[model samples]
Target chain A: MGRTTFHTDPVEALAGVADGDTVLVGGFGMAGMPVRLVDALIDVGAKGLTIVSNNAGNGETGLAALLKAGRVAKVICSFPRQADSYVFDGLYRAGEVELEVVPQGNLAERMRAAGAGIGAFYTPTGVGTLLAEGKEQRTIDGRDHVLEMPIRGDWALIAAQAADPMGNLVYRKTARNFGPVMATAAATTVVEVRETVDLGAMDPEAVVTPGIFVDRVVTS
Target chain B: MTAQQGLPLDVSGAAEHPEPLDRAGLAARVARDVPAYAYVNLGIGQPTTVADHLDPAQGVVLHTENGMLGMGRAAHDDEVDPDLINAGKVPVVEPPGASYFHHADSFAMMRGGHLDVCVLGAFQVSAAGDLANWHTGAPDAIPAVGGAMDLAIGAKQVFVMMSLFAKDGSPKIVPSLTYPATGLACVDRVFTDLGVFAVDHERGRVVLLEAYGTTAADLAERLTGA
Candidate 1:
């Protein structure tokens, strides 16, 4: 018989994540976050989570909800400016959250590297100043660059517009922002899709992420 | 006697002639307008080209969001140090007295509005002065909202540098922006390939200040569909 397992509800799926577990979330300013799953994660009350997202959503939504709940220990992203009312600044000022940022391009590449199973790559992105702190700096052919390690998550929470039961997914326009990369870079790739279909139902031309990387699916 | 015999003091060379406009000349013109002794942020690409033309005597302190202040222009090929980079992570030279700080501290300066001027490149500038530089609705493109959003609202004076029309001849300076905004009603002035215009904050209009060879009517017709 073909392998089979029960699909888990969002709350139960995320319940066992301990404090300080690294979580990579997919979205670009409220575009593709698993809003319902995020709410369930908040309900799970996991603290000290180091969240990786493109931008924190507004205070009442998604990742910002976790920030507001005082659950996120750190945020790693490209722009905190997208957060409503500058919550990142407030958290930083209050010592409630630590913040790290990569140039937007490098952030994407790092996620790609993580998914590709590469240990690290040298990029010109953060060679100088504080971004170089505690990282290996090397010079090649008379030019200097720092080695930034790839970021992998213990759990990847990704939102998709569509997902087939076998886990192939498709994202709407800007919703494709960070989903596909996070899907492969996490130990457990939990997918939340607006519509879920049976295996082999989605057209191969439309699939953004292949099914093999996904470990769970939640139909929003 | 020998000097006079060899060359009769070429008066033509001594006489000034109007040099044709070029990228460097345009950059110099932009630099000439930036007030001295101001904290300024320069964006990547075309806007970064403006630094090449900044007069050495001008006391403009450049800030890079990755935590360096007093960044100089691109270094000579022989002087390039890949270790010194700007916010865009391009190799750059640190000017004298350049300081480094934590990323959060750097953002604090921006959020606290310590920057006096920010020069940016834009894909679109709405007639109401909204900026949209990050996402352009391209399928192959990744929408990276860099420091544009912070610098858009953080600086007291926001100056945009871009071509008036995109390569396809569509007006980039528009009556209303279609892309997602970096900041709402935050832009102050625009310096474009066509001309310079001031944002009329109260009236929600773009007041033409100077256009190289075009008129306000012509610009209005192309940009506003007026």
Candidate 2:
């Protein structure tokens, strides 16, 4: 019945992440990225990590910075080759990094399934594409679907606009893209919020992620 | 200027080599065929241009897989909101009554057959209506499929926008695709710079519905030939 504690330092909030850990980062491109936590992970120098996100991040920011630092061994993302994802491109070409390119819808569902404690689910997203290669396929109700396993992370770093002392979070605009789903799919969820208020400050209905799923909160 | 005005204008020579429609022209032609009040998704590259040519009165809703519905046209440099972007990661404005949801929900709208039409760019489209656009699988190419596969299969009607020929003069519409398939029997129509084609999946043939600067017979020959 104890409440979740907030961390004043980003490094301390991300202390649980270690080398070879799988980290789920919440964002769509640059939006909703937990900048401070990402910076903290870079500072901590966790190596050979598996990073999951939507994009590789535009320019040298967020996940790109992590990849540029050579801390990531692999990246699982939908849009891994954006106009500005030169970091991933360079590493991938040099055989220094690996990439698992999942379809956007499948990516979101896999993460959701992880949080929901589901083993796996069938999706029609990548049926005939390269993404469907080697994956199990089944015909359901006269249609084809590919079986995708749940995607879980050792730690999840997410961003939010506001949070209460109990760790309930509310995100801003499109910034909320992967935050809620990533929060559930991780063993430990650390949220970076702009502001922290009292327990009841966030309206119960407005909270997208309940406090029970979060383990730490950091003000960025 | 006076000498040019008095010339015969080389009209016969001009007719010998008709120019294909430009990118915007191709998009506008595709826009003309989009049904009114339809909910549509536009894939990146040439297909995104359809948003610019759509009639404002048509009430077509643009859905972005990154969690936005009722998205507006591309935003100007000054109006760019970094956080507000389409699935392609390009900045865009949102029209009134626009709603944002979780990424999963936005995808559900796409995969659950709620979209009326999806316009996409293809590397190659088979005569049997199969689509292949995600990757060429070249040695140097970075494979990033994104949402093209989902939109290809889930949308009620899949419309493709692409050039009729590759830069090497290879026909993009062929009897069978050389590239990997994105979806099977998914495409209903294709709008290329040369013409608009209706794919007859059952017969494994593509019928030229309209031509811009080329004749149907010439286009068909090109498509049917090696």
Complex DockQ per candidate: 0.05, 0.65
True contacts kept of each: 0.07, 0.69
Here, model 1's chain A TM-score works out at 0.90
For all predictions, the C-alpha RMSD in Å is: 19.3, 7.1
lDDT top scorer? 2
Model 1, chain B only, scores a TM-score of 0.84
Give the clashing residue pairs of candidate 2, or none. none
Best by TM-score: 2
Model 1 chain A weakest 10-residue run by lDDT:
A1-10
lDDT of 1 by residue, B1-226 (tens): 2211221111111212234235666677678788988888888777788877777688888887655688766667877654456665456676678875433346556645798888988888876788878667564332356666667766889998888788988777666666666666778987776666778778776766665555555555565553
Which digits, one per residue and each the tens of the lDDT, describe model 1 over residues A35-128? 8778888989889999987665567767777898999988888766542535666677677787776555456657778988899977533443
Quote the B-chain TM-score, candidate 2: 0.88
What is the model-wide C-alpha lDDT for candidate 2? 0.84
Give DockQ: model 1.
0.05
Q: Which candidate is the best by DockQ?
A: 2
How does residue B24 of candidate 2 score in lDDT?
A: 86
Worst 10 residues of 1 chain B by lDDT: B7-16
User: How do the residues B1-226 of candidate 2 rate in per-residue lDDT, one tens digit apiece?
Assistant: 3211221111111122266789888889899999999999998877888988999898899888888889887789788887788877788887789987888888888889999999999999887788999889788998887888778888999999999889998878776777988888899998888877788777766777767687655664565541
